[model samples]
Target: MKNYILITLTNALGLYIASLLFPAITLSSIAAVLWAGLLLATISLFLKPLLLLISLPINFITFGLFTLLINAWLIQLSAYLAKGVSIPNFKYALIPAIIIFALNRARLSLIHDKS
Candidate 1:
């Protein structure tokens, strides 16, 4: 649980940074964005792994490529849930989704390595 919260906070930090960099990604305010990111990260904790498992055949056939689309969906969902956040297009969501993936990978790796 602690690890999950830490990861969520990190993801929120990444989203906050993204908002600062893209006008189209702006939230009504920083507080709203923080809430959105937390909610997104919480949702992702269960969703990403389950979706990956359920989509295993497609993921295998696509050589892991379809994961990007799943990520895009997750990002779009986050935007939808967020009261004040918005994304301009698929491209905008893709960029941040990829960033979040990278962060997740790095975090998991570091955690495993520290054991």
Candidate 2:
């Protein structure tokens, strides 16, 4: 769908920007960035919600900071799933995860769904 394509593109842009800003996150090629973006989008769309649902109690207890940890985990998982994208450690992943999350949030806020 159009929305999915748009989201994937937005995610790709986010990854590109994050790589630029963070030396800790590297994209070996454009292809890798695109793959990382696609994997990230898929994981965010499917797995994140399920994990959030299962972690709701802990999320509530942590006053939502646990969601940031989840975001970092998702970023690391995307790195694992996509070749040539490497996040060396959780510390390396945290900032990029925050950046990507912010980028996606801003993109979603600015786009209105016609359907």
Candidate 3:
């Protein structure tokens, strides 16, 4: 339960920051959208990366960038699953997915640096 909340908060923070950077994505309100996005993105956090890995051959076949399209799709799916939240556009969804992915990778490196 605690881990779930933590992941949600992290995702919410990422989405909030992402909205600031991209104009197309708009949250109905910060708190509401944050929590909604957090919940939805938490599910994606667990599922999307594994799916992407499973499709790695095709992703590479399309040139590595196709993974970006997959990430964008997952983000849109999350928004679709979460009520009262809107991605506004695919370009908007792409922004947060990329930001979160890069941030997560950087965070993993930071954690390992301490160990």
Residue-by-residue lDDT tens digits, candidate 3, 1-115: 8656655666677677887877666677777666665765676768877888898999889888887777777778877776656788787888887887777677668768999
Per-residue error (Å), model 1, residue 4: 1.8
Better of 1 and 3 by TM-score: 1
Best by lDDT: 2
Against the unseen true structure, what C-alpha lDDT does each candidate score?
Answer: 0.80, 0.84, 0.74
The top-ranked prediction according to TM-score is 2
Residues 18-102 of candidate 1: C-alpha lDDT, one tens digit per residue? 7777777777877777777787787787798999999999999999988998887887788788788888788888777777778
Q: State the local distance difference test value for candidate 1.
A: 0.80
- Candidate 2: worst-modelled 10 consecutive residues by lDDT: 106-115
Q: Candidate 3: where are CA atoms >4 Å away?
A: 1-6
Clashing pairs in 2: none
